[model samples]
Target: MSRERVSFTELTDVSQKYWPEASVGVSLIAPAIYRLHEYLNRLARELFKQYNLQSAEFETLCALRNSPEPYRITPTELYRKLLVSSGGMTKILLRLEDKELIERPANLADARSRLVALTPKGKSLIEKVTAQLIEQEAELVARIDQPGQLEQHLLRWLAQIESHQDDKGPHL
Candidate 1:
């Protein structure tokens, strides 16, 4: 026997009976994006756990690894790059320092600011973990393929959205 298909409207009506007060104005895009974000976070958390690391630690390592010449960054710089609050960055740095995974050095630029850099041991560990993480990430993306192309398309979409930011502000 063939089953009859239920349209979205039918599902919405059925949902109201069970949900009672759920707004019908909900859009699929928001929920789908949220689910995708959660899925990626879970996968990342699992992968990082294999190295005894977290996403925040991995990001800090990458930042240090990518730094030019001196291979160091200030807490303020790290905070800006990671989009984390100052207090949160300080806690992260403290944790990494406790692990001896990174070092805090006197900043030549300004005495008030301290510079953060990977220790020799930290560098070795980051190199090892990063190699494994890269392979894992590649595998994850391979399931979908053309991740670079997808990233480019997403970048374009994001740029378009960002372009409209000023439109909401008051005109001069």
Candidate 2:
């Protein structure tokens, strides 16, 4: 089977015909951003599926594994860090617990909250998966002629966008 490949030129041509008033900047950058987002998402899903993990499950495990000693943290903290709702986090935690990948132990310091820690199995899984993910990411960008320069440019661009977000003005 074969797939048709759409070029950036075609995209710009279509945009130019459909929306003549739009700036060239938007026509180029917007589609590129969307395509990059889609490609990254698909890659992430494939990587997670290889380990039989959903994105949320992998993120939750990563949160616990990246925490301090014993790699434990509160559910509240996890949800906050992940920008997930309390109810949504609870469901993710429940699934992890059911899989024996995490445990909800009594928080000796605070009776109100429970500590979520990775099981040895979970720790091992995260370590292995994380390494694989990093390797895959590196491979994806390896073809770039100047990755460091690209990274610096992206960082500056993203920072500029973030800094201006609160200005309540038009953005490019």
Candidate 3:
């Protein structure tokens, strides 16, 4: 008995409609990764807009909620965690502070340093949004049948890849 060979068409039928003429080598892996990343990021942006927050602001709020002790993190810590430059982090902090969602405190340990923390209202907002975000994420990730396994696999794949880089260099 002989088995038939499967063509690329069979593996990537749906993708061809939009990315027709894509090279076999590039199309197979790169497009899928790009599309999935794009879609998820778009969805996150939409969700953040619903809360009158941008993606960066939402992330900072959530990060504060997850922090140790006083639920505050220094500007340096936040910039490091968010993988943004000091100026970029400053902009985000100013925007969130304008919304009264966070507080800036003079760090006792270092007078020149400032720490950012979520306000009570910020905590409340995150608690509410987190539940909603989790539900949305669950629905999105449910598209993957075995999410736990898929998540693990994706994390391992990402870890094996080089660090995310920008035009400047390897992102911190």
Candidate 4:
């Protein structure tokens, strides 16, 4: 069976009919955000493909790229930040290392662990990809003509969610 794309208005209407007491906030915003997330994920997959990169590899590069200058972090930190298992991080690091996109150097502070550093080539690649990705993402908000306002709203909502999550204790 094919799933037809339903308009937001129709969805809300049908949802209300099914559950008269359904909260509009959940019915509307959750679905809207979910649909947008699906679209963005597809867009990101296509963009990552053009760079011949897997999602985890690209994300690992990003985590390194966004870190303090010299762009290095311990593998443990990388796995924690990415929420992947140690074994998973090892595989990702190995693949990235083969591409010369990252280098693992012995951590002077810790003999037991090595630091993951972004290579100059990796920096260049990530920067190029980020620029293109931002350009493409901008199109999604172009019609809104109030990207800043939208971002502020999202930030507030995110902070609230994060705060609630924090109350539950450490994520991993």
Candidate 5:
């Protein structure tokens, strides 16, 4: 199926009319970034739904899958890695446990914390879902004429933004 191509002309026009003091690049880049985020999020949500997983749940599984042998990590570590709150991580872990996709066992090192690990079923499901997501992402990026070049540019842009995160004043 064909879709209408996105363009920045309207953004530029509106910026010029209502916010002439701002750089036109701001209008172009911000909306493009937001739209790109929305599009990718929509695709990810669809993929997660197909696998009976929420985005957070999938992320938690991935974190476990990437960990050392036995594929286990502490709840605090998982929350930190996923940039989520402890309470939220606890809820996600509880849901996955109920679904028999994950387990929470008392931590030997820290009695105050618990270790999270994938069940056999969780491992199987994550493997399948991750493979499908990789395929979908490959297909999506393949649409671009120079996917590698696009990736490099995006990475550089992101790095620049991240490097300036600690600055007290706006660097953009």
Candidate 6:
């Protein structure tokens, strides 16, 4: 799983030599974006490993961390927000509770399900991890000049794509 990927240069070279009729720059756009996405995922996995956490576990913590004050949400809410199955969310919640990173308190609104909230330790740890993640991401982008402009371009591109998805109807 530690194999290196083919470079963008190689991809461009193939497009130019084998498919001369196509616009090489335009043709390579999606592949380039996909490669970057893969690299970012790998980077996040490595960072999470350093904290002895699985990516899903970190995501669960983050969902709670980013929630409204009191930092609590029902298991159903967590599963929906994290786009995980209810069973998967249950496993993640159990692991986090075992780690003492979160606590489940009785939900006054409903007796059937408990509210998941960050413990004092969980809150502090998440804040520290979030800061580190920001620092690491900033360092990755610092190599490029005009990073802010690049961000704006990406934001616009994302918005356009999302709008097209809207036209296609609801996501599954």
Candidate 3 lDDT, 43-127, residue by residue in tens: 7788778889988898889889999857898988988988889999999999999999999988999998889998998998988
lDDT of 5: 0.87
Taking all chains together, the TM-score of candidate 6 against the true structure is 0.86
So what's the TM-score on candidate 5? Answer: 0.82
What is the alpha-carbon RMSD of candidate 4 to the true structure?
3.1
TM-scores for all predictions: 0.71, 0.84, 0.77, 0.85, 0.82, 0.86
Off by over 4 Å in 3: 1-22, 162-172
Predicted candidate 6 versus true structure: per-residue lDDT over 2-34, tens digit per residue: 788678898778878998778634656677788
Candidate 1 stretches with Cα past 4 Å from truth are: 1-30, 145-149, 165-172
Worst 10 residues of 1 by lDDT: 27-36
- Pitting candidate 1 against candidate 5, the one with the higher TM-score is 5
lDDT of 4 by residue, 9-92 (tens): 787788789986775556467678888898888898999999999999989999999899999999988899999999999999
**CA lDDT, every model vs. true structure:** 0.80, 0.87, 0.82, 0.90, 0.87, 0.87
Among all candidates shown, the one with the greatest lDDT: 4
Which consecutive 10 residues in model 2 have the weakest lDDT in total? 22-31
For 1-172, candidate 5 gives per-residue lDDT tens digits of 9687545677667778999888645546666778777778888899999888999999999999999979999887889999999899989999999999998878899999789999999999999999988898888888889888988998999898888877845665
> Ten residues in a row with the worst lDDT in model 4?
20-29
Task: Estimate the Cα RMSD of every predicted model relative to the unseen true structure.
Answer: 7.0, 2.9, 8.4, 3.1, 3.6, 2.6
Query: What are the clashing pairs of model 3?
Result: none
Provide the lDDT at 9 for model 2.
81
lDDT of 5 at 72: 91
Q: What is the lDDT of residue 21 in candidate 4?
A: 76
Q: After superposition, how far is residue 80 of candidate 6 from its true place, in Å?
A: 1.6
Model 3 C-alpha RMSD vs. true structure (Å) is 8.4
Better of 2 and 4 by lDDT: 4
Tens-digit lDDT string for candidate 1 (27-110): 555555566576667777887788778788888888888888467988888889898899988888888899898999999889
Q: Each candidate: how many clashes?
A: 0, 0, 0, 0, 0, 0
